[model samples]
Target: MASNRPAPQAPFAPDASEPFAYGAPRAEDGVWEEWNPTEESLPAVRGRHRVAKQRGGGLARSSTVLGVGVIAAVGAGGMASANTGKPPVSIALPDLPSVDSLIDGHHHTETPAASLSGVATATATAVGDSTADAGEALRSRIMAQAERQQSKADSRATAAAVAKADQQAAEAAAKAAKEASVKAAAAKEKAEADAEKKAEQARLAALAKQYTLPTSSYTITSTFGQAGSMWSSGYHTGLDFAAPTGTLIKAIHSGTITEAGWAGAYGYRTILTLDDGTELWFCHQSSISVSAGQKVSTGEVIGRVGATGNVTGPHLHLEVHPGGQPTGIDPGAWLRGKGLTP
Candidate 1:
């Protein structure tokens, strides 16, 4: 029974390593908890401890500020080195070709076939685009040239048409002028011809007023101044104008009335005595227009012829005397001297 009894009284002494005993109660909390932690177990609960409220909060904030300061310092150092134009800090070529080893190797004589192939492809593309651009430029130039040529041709045609029209107009005007001149000349000639014809008609009328004849168609049947026993004066002294009965008779000269009556030997007689005392006897008249003492003038129809006297046929016995003598001279020569043929 004595061996089985629990012993009591271990003195209360603090251990350096172990701050709290496993079964002892803490003085401040009355709970059994470990105060000191081990190195291996420290990582698990390094941030779990607490102090005073203000001190712990300041300590946590100071740790966060230190971490930010460290990161800013490293960024500032890198920027300063870059601005100073320094080389890279580390060189780790992952994909770049090692030109150094190739230069140290054997002299490799070969064509740059791969590089040439790339250059050729690029040059061919450039040449193809250049050709297409040149072709477009040439076509544009050709179209412009053609337009210019067409414009020139149209101008020439217009000029030619204008010239031709001018020539035609000139020709028409000249023709009209020539025709007018010809018409003027023809009108002047016709006027001259008409003047000449009128002058000739005036001359013929003046001549008709001067000469006279008794009958239109007559013959000299007997003559005056013949020594024969044929007249009452024992000689032929009158000119006989033998014509058909009823033939027209005219006065030989302008005179006044003497006798217009029938005589025995001179049938149907008309005697006209002129102002100069020359007596003209007209016989063998069919009628008489004047009385025995009626006055007469030139061209007066005094009598007409008839066979009422001692005549064998129808005739006009005419006699001209100087002073109304019974016998007359040759009247043919006398009338011919006064611009009359009969």
Candidate 2:
């Protein structure tokens, strides 16, 4: 629609080289009007300069809002990158869904320019939420790792204690076994000693019943191996018992009388031969009661004491010849070994 308004044009420099200029505006019928500056219009000029700021806070405020929007967009981009596993861009502008549509589960068809403010707010909130969630997950993982390490340490300590106890128990068992073995050995040794003592006593008891003495009512006159001038050998080889002239002299053991005759020096000597081939001689007897080849029992009278054959008085000489050899052993020691005290 055409109206009676002015057409705006470039300012005209009235003088060619002058810095002063003025607007050349034409009405619809093509008429020019004069314009000039004055102190009276100074307030009007200042008002014209502030017109855009009064309308919408001017370019500075718009730049501040745009900067805040850009910051919000970058934060939202970081959150989106974390959520979607993508890299973030250096400058990002957000495309936000409307809160109303999201709350109602409905789609809002909006123009990009119309929804910019709401998208920036939602992007900041999403960035904050994602950061909080990641912090919480990291804290949980660290706490779990600490708990597992503590459990492993506790298990190692418990195992060490158990192993120590087992080693001590094994050592104790070994010590007890050693002590028991020592005690058992001592007991066995003692038992063997007692058994040996009892066996010796039993042997002596049986031997006491089998032997007898050579004479009765007699006093020991001479010991064996005594140096004397009356003896033919260098030492007297027989034990002598001084008795009455007619005293009875008994056989020392069960034996056969091998000889009952006069010997030149040991007159009226009688020899008794035992089953084990040992010979006993009873000499200087007043009279012989047993004949040769006669078997005589122990304690039976075999001869009488006489003062004959290299004797100072009436005495019986007793000699022992082991294995029927001619060499005589000491008779007093042999008699005492058969349980006789003399």
Q: Which candidate is the best by TM-score?
A: 2
**Root-mean-square deviation of every model:** 30.2, 15.9
Candidate 2: regions farther than 4 A off = 1-207, 217-246, 264-267, 310-315, 329-340
Q: Scored by Cα lDDT, where does model 1 land?
A: 0.65
Clash statistics: count for each candidate: 8, 1
lDDT of 1 by residue, 1-342 (tens): 367768786667566455322335558776554455455665443576744233323433543454345344444544444455342132111222223224332332333334334443444444444555665788899999999999999999999999999999999999988898888888878887887667755654554465477666888877877676656677777788777777777776667878878688877788888887988888878887777666765566777666778777778888888897766778887776554666
Q: Following a full C-alpha superposition, what root-mean-square deviation does model 2 have from the true structure?
A: 15.9
Please tell me which predicted candidate would have the highest lDDT against the true structure: 2
Please, what are the lDDT tens digits per residue for candidate 2 over residues 1-342?
888888887454455443233234436547644456465765654544553322222333544566576666667677777777564344434554444344332344433643444555556556656766786798899999999999999999999999999999999999999999999999999999889877856765565567777767889878999997778787899988888999888887898999999998998999999989999999988899989999988788998889878778999889999998889898888877776755
TM-score of 1: 0.37
lDDT of 1 at 53: 31
What is residue 20's positional error in candidate 1, in angstroms? 99
User: Candidate 1, which segments miss by more than 4 Å at Cα?
Assistant: 1-208, 227-229
Cα deviation at 16, candidate 1, in Å, is: 99
